[model samples]
Target: MNILMAIHIGAGLLALPAGTIAVAVRKGGRLHARAGTAFFGSMVVLGITAAILGPFREPEPLSPVAPLFVLYFVTTSWVAARRRDGSTGRFEILACAAALGTSAVMYWGVVMDGATTPAGPGVIYVLASVCLLAGLLDLNAILRSPLTPARRIARHLWRMCFAFFIATGSFFIGQQDILPAAWRGSPALLLLGFAPFAVMAFWLARVRLGKRLRASLQALPERKLA
Candidate 1:
């Protein structure tokens, strides 16, 4: 248990910085790719460890399904990025099922059991809602098949950004006790915790709403023929 805790903490520490670097650097650049890869690796370890350790925590054990949420987002995002041809596969189907199942479990815990997560019911509700929405989006994409480049990029961007948000929130807000007493409950900490959402929104708009970006994405298929 101690060893698992150590590994989990270590992965979280690594993930926080790696995810920040991935978000900070220019997208599709070598630095961004390397940082994103590092972040993905660290998050996989963190998620696995957290899921395993959650059930054993003292006083009140955590719901293991929570960590799986991060895992689902990161994994699906990675797949979306890798499938440059905008193809869908069985994995997306499996991921959709996982997301829906997770949402159901979370909703049941909060509504039926009257259980609150460590961060409270509000966070759980938000997480559950996002999971449900993601699942629906997954189904839509699968049914639509061969997504547009812009849509695929949008999918990858939001999920990865959301995963980063989770990591940032866990560290900046959830672990505020590790900071100096003066910094505790500081507004700066709150901003840092939520900064990823701002970044995500900016990039999503760029991908989805920008005319130039849409044009470039549309040109991708034609360029391949030459």
Candidate 2:
């Protein structure tokens, strides 16, 4: 395993964080809107780069999963952004449900594979569901009240950030097959990516749930985030 390569790749992915922090610095400000464009642009660049080089660089399911995640992120991000008209339509609900259900299943899968993933995937799955449910409810509330508060938008921003964090972690773990067998169990070397793939799956589920949960909380009188 090229330890340097893994670190380099993971660190490079942090650009997404930079863009995210910028827009989420204070939701709804002109600067926030401007930074958001940059954040999306940066992610697009990262996704495209990963896609074009990912297949040759990494083999099997991991490579494909990366691109697929990118596509999902892009499409969903678009829906999340453009669908900001405050109306949660059938498509939105369908997409959220599918994403949430998938996360739930994935989490259960990891939990079943306890040998490799002791933490289980359900944690992530439930988290993603929370976000999704919250987002839906919040969207409805916003439609009625027509206001996306700073903290609320920041929570939304963090939800995506967390998702990206999980994806980046997966990229490292999924590449394990490429690592030297000796390096596989090297604590210092592999600690960061020891369970790369399962972690990603977990995060994917959590982030999606967070999306829904945020909506749910938004709609509630308490106005909290899950």
CA lDDT of every candidate: 0.90, 0.50
TM-score for predicted model 2 compared with the true structure: 0.44
In candidate 2, residue 17 scores what lDDT?
54
Which whole-number lDDT from 0 to 100 does residue 174 have in model 1?
84
Give the per-residue lDDT of model 1 (tens digit) for 42-82: 89998999999988888888777768878998999999999
User: For every candidate structure, what is the RMSD over all alpha carbons to the true structure, in angstroms?
Assistant: 5.3, 10.8
Which candidate wins on lDDT?
1
Q: For model 2, what is the alpha-carbon lDDT of residue 74?
A: 45
Off by over 4 Å in 2: 1-14, 17-24, 48-78, 104-155, 164-226
Which pairs of residues clash in candidate 1, taking residues 3 or more apart in a chain or in different chains? Answer: none
Instruction: Give per-candidate clash totals.
Output: 0, 33
> Which candidate comes out best when scored by TM-score?
1
